[model samples]
Structure formats: C-alpha cells, structure tokens
Target: MSDERTAVRERAEAVLRRLAGDGARLRDDQWRAIEALVVDKRRVLCVQRTGWGKSAVYFVATALLRAGEPGGGTRSATEESAATGPAGAGPTVIVSPLLALMRNQVEAAARAGIRARTINSANLDEWDAITAEIHDGAVDVLLISPERLNNPEFRDTILPRLAATTGLLVVDEAHCVSDWGHDFRPDYRRLRTFLANLPAGTPVLATTATANARVTADVAEQLSTDASGRLGEDALVLRGPLDRESLRLAVLDLPNPTHRLGWLADHLDGLPGSGIIYTLTVAAAIETAEFLTARGYAVASYTGQAEDADRRAAEQDLLDNKIKALVATSALGMGFDKPDLGFVVHLGAPPSPIAYYQQVGRAGRAVEHADVLLLPGAEDEAIWRYFASLAFPPEDQVRRVLDALDPDRPMSTQALEPIVDLRRARLELMLKVLDVDGAVRRVRGGWVATGQPWVYDEARLRRVAEARTAEQRAMREYAATSTCRMRFLRECLDDPEATDCGRCDRCAGPWFEADVPAQALDAAGAFLGRPGVPVPVKKLWPTGLEAVGVPLKGRIPPAEQTLPGRAVGRLSDLGWGDRLRALLGPDAPDAEVPAELVGAVVEVLKDWAHGAEPWPRRPVGVVAVASRRRPRLVRSLAERIAAVGRLPLLGAVVPVGEEAAGGAWGNSAQRVRGLHGTLEIPSELAATVAELDGPVLLVDDLVDSGWTMAMAGRLLRQSGAPDVLPLALAVAG
Candidate 1:
C-alpha cells in the first residue's frame, strides 16, 4: 500500500509540475484528494481557500484515471473487474459555473497536455463538433456551464452517454449546490439528477472555497448519494484553513456615496497594482467608471447588461494590466482568475461575509501581499433589501406558474409572462426549481408540465430566508467589528482553524487612508450630482399581449410612440438615488414635489432642449399621468415643469377603474393590459390636447415598467397631440 501511494504521488507531482512549473509540488491535502479519487474511486469534497490548488488535484486525478494505472496494480478486486472497460475511454466532465472559469480551466488543462473543450451559450455553434471529439475519445476534459446541464438536447441525448462513460465528474464552485450558500443558484440543484445517472465506479469531486459549515455539510450529503438515490457510507472531505496570509483586510466607513467615490478617486492609484472596483449595481458601476475615466484613469465598466463581446474585452484589458481597474458588479465574481491581482475595493458591502471573501479571494492569490478594502455605504442595507425582494415567490405564485404550464404542449416563458406576475428572471428561477422537483420539464421549444405533484416545501424555503437574514446581520457585524478582520471573515465561513492574521486593520491598525482629498471630494460630488439618464422609447409591444386582452403586438405605430425622453436620474444612481427611494418608496407619504428636485428637473429639461439631439420641437403643453398613490407629487411635477418651460398645464390623463390602480409591479404585458383601457384623456384634457401646436411634455413622478408612459403617451397622441415627450423624476432600473 505504501509503495502504491508513492507511485500515485509521483505521477500527481509530474502533472502538477507541468501545470505549474518544474518546481511545483502538491500540498498534503491535494495529494490525499487525488489519492481518494484516482486510487479509491471515491467521491470527494474539497473545501479549501483560494490559491490552494484544488484545480490541480482534479487535473492530476484526470490524468491518472485516464492512464488506467490506478497506482500501478494497487486496484482492489472490484476495481480490477471494472478495468475491463477500455483505457482512456471517456473524458472528464467538469460542470463549472461561469464562462471565465471554464476558459481558465481549459487553458490550464492544456498545460498538462490535456485537450479541453467547452459548450456554453457563447459556443453554441461549436457544441456539435466538440461532442463529436468527446465521443471519438480525443478530448480529455469537457467543461460545461451549470445551465447547460438542463439544455433540452444535451440533457436528453448527450448527458446520458457522458454520464455512462465519464472518467471523472467534477463540480467546481460546489458551494452553489447548497441553498444555504451565499450565492445559491437554482440550476445547480440539477446536479443531483446527473449524479444519480453516473455509472458505478466513476469518481466524483466537488470543489469550492466559500462554503460555511452548513453549506459544506449540505454539499457533502449530495456528493455522497449513489445512483440509487441513497446516501453512501464513504465520501472523503478535505477542509483546510481559510486564512489568506497575503491579504491585508480593512474597512473604511464612509459618510455617503460621495465620500466613497472621492476616496476611490484620490487613492485608487496608490493601491498596489491593477485590480477590481466592485459596485452594488450596474448604474453605480457605469457612473463610477465614467467618473474615474474623466479623472484621467484607464478604467471600464463591466456588468451583466454589457454585451458579451464588451465583457470579454474588459476582462482581457484587466488581465493584461492595460486598464487601471474594472468597475464591476457581482457579475464579475466567481472563478475569475488573476494570480497577481493587487487589490480589491468594494464601493458597498456585500450582503454577507462569505460572498465578500469569495470576491476578495480573486486578489492575493499569487502575490506576496494584496490590499482588500470595503467602503460600506449607508445604503448597503437598502440594496440588500432590494435583492431579497427577488427571492422565491409565495406558494400562490408558484402554483400559478405550474397551472399555466400545459402537460401536452410547451409554453415559452414569453407566452407565460402575461399569465404570471413574476418577473422574467424570478420566473425562470422558479421554473428551474420546479424542474428539479419533477413538476416541470424544459423541452426543445420551452417548458411543459410533468403532471407531477410538488410540495411547496415552505419550511425549507423559510429556513433559507432566515439564513439569508442571518448572513446580512453577520455582514453588518463584520463591518463594525474591531476584532481581526481576516479572522472574522474566516469564522463567518465556519473555518475550523480560523485565527487572527495579525495583518488586518483591527489586528495592526489602519492600513488605508480615511480622508478624501478636498478636490476629489468636490469632483466626485459634482460628477454624481450631474443628472439626466435617457429614457429609451419602447419600440415594440411585448409578445402575446393579446392573451391578456390587449390587441397590441409587433412594432408600436410610429405616430403613437413617445419620443426619446429624459429622467432627472435613475433610482439606482449614486447621488439622488437614496432621496428618490425615500420619496417614492411604498411607505413614504406623498406630498408636493420638493423645490430641489424641481430644480433638478429644470436642469434636465435645459439639457434636453439644447443638447445634441434636442426634442424635435419645443413643447407647447404639459400633461401628468394620474397617480392614485402620488397624485400630489405627479401633478406638482407637471405644474412645476410647465411653469419653468412656459408651457400650458394640460389636464392629467385619468385612470378609470380599479385595474388602473394596480401599481407597476408585474411584467410588461400585464402592465400594458392594466393600463390599456384604464387610462383615458379626460374630455377637457382631450380638447386641450387637440389644440396643442407642438409636442406635449408628459410628466410623471417615476417610470418603472415604462408601460404607463407608453400607454399614457399613446392615449394623448390618439387624442390629437402632434407628439409626446416623456419626462420623469426618476427611472427604475
């Protein structure tokens, strides 16, 4: 046994040397994991810190498994029988979470003389060829996104064959398998089915750096389950200390967004090397990147909304150290590899320490030292609440979705949007959960019911929500803790060997400057205070609107469409965002428009009047969309705009029934249906609009779905206004 172990270790080291360097060696835990996978053919769960070479273990194990050596004749009787299968018969299938991670793994595999291929949304056209290579036994590693596991074609045809022949199955970023994890994904739950289908004696490995004790146990349980859906007795778990010695952790409490922005601008260059600046929202990322660029910094904004090509370009620029930093959101997190990333700065605190650790782990991986700073804003809790609102819907919503799905025919998500109240993202998530539960199935065209009853599992969902709340509370405590910051994060992740690192702010005192330069502060304030985001015109009606009793479909008539408009700011903006949230939040009491906001509105109108693409003609009249919740605020905004622009105050478009009172909370089709016949021009207003000489300024307190603006503007145009221009105080992102 000892000699066999030595042989296995030698082979692993050789592979590691190729992947790393001539001097590379496997750590004790890495060797143990490789031994369990390649020699014992056992399932293993590895929870180690970043830069711990978890990937190295799997790559080496893949090499050893395909070579059919099994530690040079150390195989047991059962393994010897299983050896009847052809050598190098199958590729190692790695279910990864992000495209960036897949790319990194593919490149790393090549270093070990392994041929790797990926099939993701980005490489759809190449999937057929790649699958052929895998069948031909020419591919050593196959990386796929978690979402691809449920692809109708892949799941129905390709996955079963791969499961039967796969040499080793690896689940990277395995923490996502647990709903209790900070970044839980519903699609990851599909792995259970895949696991149940794998052939006997096939090795499996799950790797992650972010799971806490609860999440770790959850993931381990899933990994241990056998093909019969029963838990197995033996599964190896290798957990290591979570401390990152090279990281210098600190938290700077800024008074507001202005101070945080100013601090970044003044001190970004002083940070060790090129790195990432994380913002909580897309709007904030864009705003921060623009400000930094105007200040002569080489930076770019990266968000989920960015085009794939743009995201790739930004990532490459950052990797090459061509850009000072990439101002990004959580979209850039998870499996992004930059061994020498010098620093990571957060503009706002994440909802939990586990998530924060996962992101900061990107830095200090290869370097001797790296800086990690958190600038916790006062609005962090509000942002947390906003995200929490998108969590699993109530039982009624789930039932509605299931009821809408047909057993005999599939329904595309777009077709169901009019019938369901959930947003597209949340709805898709619900469908995935249901699919995993056997209540639904994704087909070639869309999704169909399975005629399987599914319990809501309310208790489990409640526990998950409670866990999220606790995580948020823990994050708040972390921001205020005077104890060792690194130790605190480790403990938050339930690291068994957590201890003070003696390098964080609380351990050795402040390592970052607290004060923002006066000039930078002024510049940041001015940049944030600068207003006006374009309100894009909706050119096409939402699909399947007729299903909701609205005849609208295809492109909206040009004459009925509102001109491109402007908003004073986005509700997700860094400057006026908090104030707008306060004024427009459900709990807030409505009142007349504040004078300062009116001034901001005037500034927006000024820019719109003379800016490059000015309104086709000066507005001759102003009209407000009647608001049941904020009538005073909406009317006052319209009145103020008319007074400033010297236009007549045309009466408001009135809502007719309770349907119109259904606030802007549903999908586009539902919103349009609610406002279709409900909003009409009052007789007096219609007469006034008929006499308008030029475009009418349509004013509202907020634009959420933009359906209200479109429907109201359509009504005005039908009533004889020559053109309609929308102006809103805030636009919801």
Candidate 2:
C-alpha cells in the first residue's frame, strides 16, 4: 500500500479504537471509504441514506487526515488554523441546520472521546467560552446552526477560528441547500455565502440521505465544488429496504379537515417506539396533538412556533420513546435522524411525491416493521393547493417585495416594512411564500430577498403543474418499479448504485401494475402531432370553409363564404370558429383559413383532409437562452416559455464549462464567487419550463456582449447536455 493509504488505515483504526476502546474493529468497506475521503482533496458529498452510519465517514476522515503528516498528503489548513489561532487551537466549527441535531452530534463525539460544544439561542456565554477553549486547543468540534452563525458576533469570532483551523466542515441534511428540495430554508442559503468567505483549502463534506438529481446539482453548486466524483469510485449507494416487509401502506381520504385529527387520534392511541403525525399547518399540528392527548396518547406538538426548550423537550421525548406520537407541521423534521420511528402518518396530502417519499423515509429507519400512511380527501387537495400556492406568489406581489429590498444594500425586514403593503402578519406570510419560491433568504434576525424579481402570471399554473407532475411521476415510478427498490432509488437519487437489495415494497410485490404512463397521457390530452380519422361533412358546416382545396367558392356549403373586403364569414355561425379566430388575434389576416379549426373542428375538418392529425393545443418546442449560469437563468426562461406560449418547459441546456483549480469554470460569477452558484430562474417563466418535457432553447440577450453565453454553452454540453438551441432577443454577430 502507498504511504498515504497506510496512513489513512491507521487513522481509521485509531478512530474505531477511540470509540469502541480495546479490540475495536472497522469494517473493510468502512475503512476503505473513510481512507479515500481523508486522502482525496475533492470535498465529499456522501449519499448514504439515514442510519447507514454516515457520521462515521466524517469522523473517520477527520481522524485519518489529522493523523497523516500535516502538509504532505493533505492541503495545508488556511491561515485560520492554530498557526492563525492564538497558538494552541484545534477547533472545527460545524455550521448545522438545527440545535437538536447539533446536540446529537456533540453527544456522539463525546462517546468517541472527542470534546464538542454547541452554541444556539439558549446559550450565548457558552459560545464565547467554547471559542476560548477552541483557541486554547482544548476543543475538538464546535456545533452551531446557520441562524446562530448569522450573528455578526458569531461570524466574527467563529469564521476567523474556522479560517485558522485545519479540521473538517460538515453539513448534515444537506438537501436543505437545494432549490429543488421541498424543505428549503432561507437560513440554509447563507451557508454558501459563509463558506465562500472562508479561508482556502478548507475541505467540506456534505451528507444527505434524500437527494434527487436536481438537489444533488444544487448541493454541489452551493459547496462550490465539481460533483464529478465526490460520492466515490466503486461507491455503491446503500439503501436499506423499501418494503417494510412487515409494515403496510394504507391511504385514507377524508371528506373534511375535521375528520382527519379524529381519525388519527383513534388510530394512534396504542402505537409505540414513537410516531410522527405530519400536518400541513401549525393549527392542524396543534389540534392533532391536543386531540391525541385528550384520547390518552402521550402526544406532543412541534413546529417553528414552539419555544426552544419546549421543542427540545418534545424531540427528546420522541428520542427516548417516551412520546407515543408527535404531531407536527411539515417544518418539524429535516435533520431528524431518528431510527426507530414506528409510524409516519400524513394527516394531509403532501404537495408532491418527493415530500411524501421524504416524510415516509422517516419511518422504518430501525430496520424494523413500520408503516407510512397517507390521508387525502377532496378537501385535502384544496388544503395542499393552498399551501403549495404559497410557494409561488403572484408576480405583482413578488415584485413589491423585491423592489423594496436592494441587493447592493444590507437587507432586513425593517427596510422592507415601509414599502410592503400587507399587514404585519400578512407580510410575514408573504415572505414565507417567497421563501418557498426560492426568491428570498431568511437571516438570523431578518429577511434577504436573494433572487431577482419577475412578474407572476397564469404561467405559474404550468410551473406548479409541471413540478407536481415530475414529483408524482418520480414517486409513482419508485413505488411501482419492477427493479429492486434500492437500485431504483439509487437511479432516482441520481447517485451511484449498489447491489439491488431485492427487498423494497415494489420488489416483494407481483410487479407494481401501476398505470402511470396511461394516466400521464390522459392528463396531457391528445398527442401533439397526430390527427384523428376524417369525419362526415354534416358535422363540418357550422364553422364554414371545408378542406383547403375543396373549391369553396363554387360548391360552397352554407358554412363557407369568401367576403368582398377580404374578410371571411362562417355560414353556420358556430361560436367555436369565432373563438378560434379571436385566439389567433388581429395580427394574422383572416383568410378562408381552415387551419385554426383543426382540433375542435376535427370532426368536420377530418372528413376533407387526409393524413396526419393537427398539432395539439400547444406544440412542444425548444428555446435555449445563453447564460454563464445555467441553474439561475435556465429555470426562469423555461417558466417564460411555459407561460406566454403554452409550451411545456422540458429541462435546461447546461453547457459544461472548463475544469479549473478545484472548481468548474465559466458558468457565472455567481457559480464561481457564490458558494452554490445557483442560477436564479425568473418566477414568471417557471410555469412554462415545467409544462414541457422536450429540448430547452438556449436563451440570452447577446452572445458577444461577453464570453458568458459561449462558456454556458460549453458547460451545458458537458453536463449530459440537453439540446442547445440558441435563442436571443439580440445577438452581436
């Protein structure tokens, strides 16, 4: 073995020994993976799901790197290390999403003989003391949430400590950083900005059990690293089981909101090992908790509204298995790593399949039998639509908030209060709406609207529908796939694949037998380019002109007539033809044009015209916009296409740029300078992109204005590139 390999194995064995003590052992796979992560300079994007001992990767990697001769195999720590600290420091600051998860990690480190401390809302002086300890070389890991990290005091002290420290940086529940992730948080957005300002050579390792293709891209972008090989060579994705072989999947559709809590209360009375009942609202969460408690179930409610202590107690109760069930809003769980959850019941319809899968993922983590139940009714659809609608605000409303907050200026809610017309509470809700829209960032004490504002319109309906469709298709595909659920999940996750576990809910069944394709077709209506068989003329007349070459002037039916002033009139006065003419608008001269009546008047037109169906209501076409940043602009243009014209917005044309020093190059300054270089899509065009599933037209204002367009084109080609049809309003050829 190379000296580096020997060094890594030695470090892994040492960490194992420290944790288990005498005679401790490391699995060959665990030892090998940990060794690769430690020696490799590329930051790690670990894709293992929950309960797969993911934290071990970090602990083992840290030990390996620390054990090796400091400068030879590893990059030297930034000036921020002890060399930069007050002489004897070895602290590694962990910017996390939650206080509870931080505590859990701290406890785990303690079990391994590592000294770790946390600083959140509950403790301020402790944070200062921990830094002193870190500066004094007594601290090992310092855990903190993004909210706390946002404090100028925290960043001032901690970032400098981090800059000088040589240890590792870890982000758990990494999906929160992805725009595509359902549980996106504005606080998470600040993580990138913070990381960007960190010292050079600081390696980051992000972990998430649930991440889709889009989420993975966003995560890698945020970490400011190329995603090429972070997961590992021969890295087999390890997913436990989809089938809870012993558990069952049940769905309930209630007629009204009142029926849901009552139903949950009666069913969850005797469940054990802790259960989580998720609702769409805080009110529902509280009501459900109250109802369950009234029925003698040791239930507690958890939401963003709960006091820190109360929330912590509730979480601890669930962890200790003291609480039979915890009722909470969808916001309650993200970094939750509980492994023995017995039941995960959705008291309402989750907005998308990704959400449903993620929530259900909380269950069956202990490798034991567990159930994921869904309760959906007619009312549930409206309720979910209401919640989902909040994710996309009306364009005017969005513009109001955007105009109020300036990017060049330091932004906060106070600066926005005067210009914002909504009531104080309503304003908060609108901000939350923008939060889900990925248009703003929520900071420690205020809000920052990070995205460029665009007008919202009917096009949003398409974006929402497209997003919903994609998520539903993904979920249904996973649930009903014929292959191993683990393998399918790996594919769905867009990560490396391991051996098929052959034990998911779908694998154990006699094939899923789902009619997803058929359902999708029905939803989309008739095919875009095909015409039906011809019909009888008796059905054609009401609208007027028959076939194109049927000699309309001579043997003209009562429905046909060529006017003297170059205007055409329908003989039978069918209102449908008039509507068609109106839709075409005043721009095109009205001829005895039978082209517009293709679909609706198909019964009449089909009789005369032979071969080929008329193009459907909306033809799918490609529209590409040239951009240095694909993620930021592509989505916006796609939304636009889907909106103005009813075209479906397929995906994006990400032109792969050149590989450079520790990062991918040429996409955008945002991609290069910002931690996650997220491409911000205009909200107005989001719907257009969602509706189409074909080629993306490359869009931009000018090609020669700069190299951004060409560079974006190159990068798009590299990233499994979609077809790049360049479309610009103006180009300086």
Name the top lDDT candidate. Answer: 1
What's the lDDT for all of these models? 0.88, 0.52
User: What TM-score would each prediction reach against the true structure?
Assistant: 0.97, 0.56
List ranges where model 1 is wrong by over 4 Å: 73-86, 659-665
lDDT of 2: 0.52
Q: How far is each candidate from the true structure, as Cα RMSD in Å?
A: 3.1, 22.4
Mind giving the per-residue lDDT tens digits that candidate 1 earns over 138-174? 7888999999999999999999988888889999999
Choose the strongest candidate by TM-score: 1
**lDDT of each residue in 583-654, candidate 2, tens digit only:** 332243323323333232333223222324432222355444424433333445445545545554544433
Clashes of each: 0, 49
lDDT of 2 at 540: 19
Clashes of 2: 49
Can you give the lDDT of residue 331 in candidate 1? 92
